[model samples]
Target: MNLSTEVRRLRDMDWGELDIKESGGWPFLLQLICCVLVLGLTLAGTYWYLAAPKLEELGQARTEEARLIRDYQSKAAQAAHLEVMREEMAILEERMNTLRDMLPTGAEVPSLIDNISEAAISNQLSIEFIRLRSPVSQEFYVEQPFDIRVRGGYHRIAEFLANVASLPRIVTQHDLTLEPMEDAGGEQLQLSMLARTYSYRQSGEEEEAP
Candidate 1:
């Protein structure tokens, strides 16, 4: 009875009970709150330090990629336009060359004149007045002729005319005045004629053979 009562009295004592309550009190609760706060702060710091920069870099990369894509598309469009222009230029060049080949070259004038003179001699006609002049009208087939005047017998004149008619190129006589010569011989006659030679020429371009 003595031991049991003493133990009971000690348990019911206010100091002992207060000491037991203080042993496990608000300090522990404050330490637990501090630890929880530290853990939360560490997690927040980790997210800011590690994840934030990566997110920023990803956003920057997306922006740069978009810019590059736009540049590539613009360049592609320009390339297509250049290709079309090149094709058009090639076609134009081909057409221009074809037209050039179809046009005649004017380099045969000397030979043509020699042939005409030979034909005149073969026809027994001596050329007296052979005059060449620049074009007058500058229009096609309406220009003045290269002038020529001759004095010969009537048969020689007729033969010369026939020879001119047989030429390959178009040769025509204009402004003809035929009369008898006053020289002592009655067989001789005086002939005046104008002949025309032509070639083609465009504005600002050199003359060409036709």
Candidate 2:
């Protein structure tokens, strides 16, 4: 049988017909693409408006917390070091007080003169002139010094100065003088010196405060 006659017979025999057409298919596909684009744009806009700022804020907060933690640690270390220094200072103060308590107090000039005389006698030297000057202010201490002249042989004068240097308190000699005695033997010489001494007071004792 012919194809059209067979199709007609099939339609008349209570069977359905299939109709195929190409019209308006492009419009339907265009509508579908538009829907997909709209959906993608909506999702991107939601993310930009709602989630991006929160993520940025979370990152900034984390950085701030880390900086605060580091600052706290540094301050804690500084406080600890300060405490240790305070303890060390207390110990030093105690030691200084003990030393000050043990030191002697008397007229410094008489003792120094007697010591000088003893050194001269032991070394077989004669003291010609000894002059002492009042102290000058040098910070918290005094710069009490003596200018001395003596006549003796070279070895004896050296022995006398050495004995003077051996005293317990600190002494420094300056402006040394040595010359041959004109009338005496060539071995005899004159010795002149400026000798210095120091004195100290206890901590917390002050001549002036501001």
lDDT of each: 0.68, 0.74
Q: Estimate each model's TM-score.
A: 0.43, 0.53
- Model 1, range 14-67, lDDT digits (tens) per residue? 652345345444344444556899999999999899989999999999999999
Clashes of each: 0, 0
* lDDT of candidate 2 over 132-178, digit per residue (tens): 77765456555677788999999999888888887765668999989
The true-versus-predicted C-alpha distance at residue 54 of model 1, in Å, is 68
Off by over 4 Å in 2: 1-106, 201-210
lDDT over C-alpha atoms for residue 145 of model 2: 73
Candidate of highest TM-score:
2
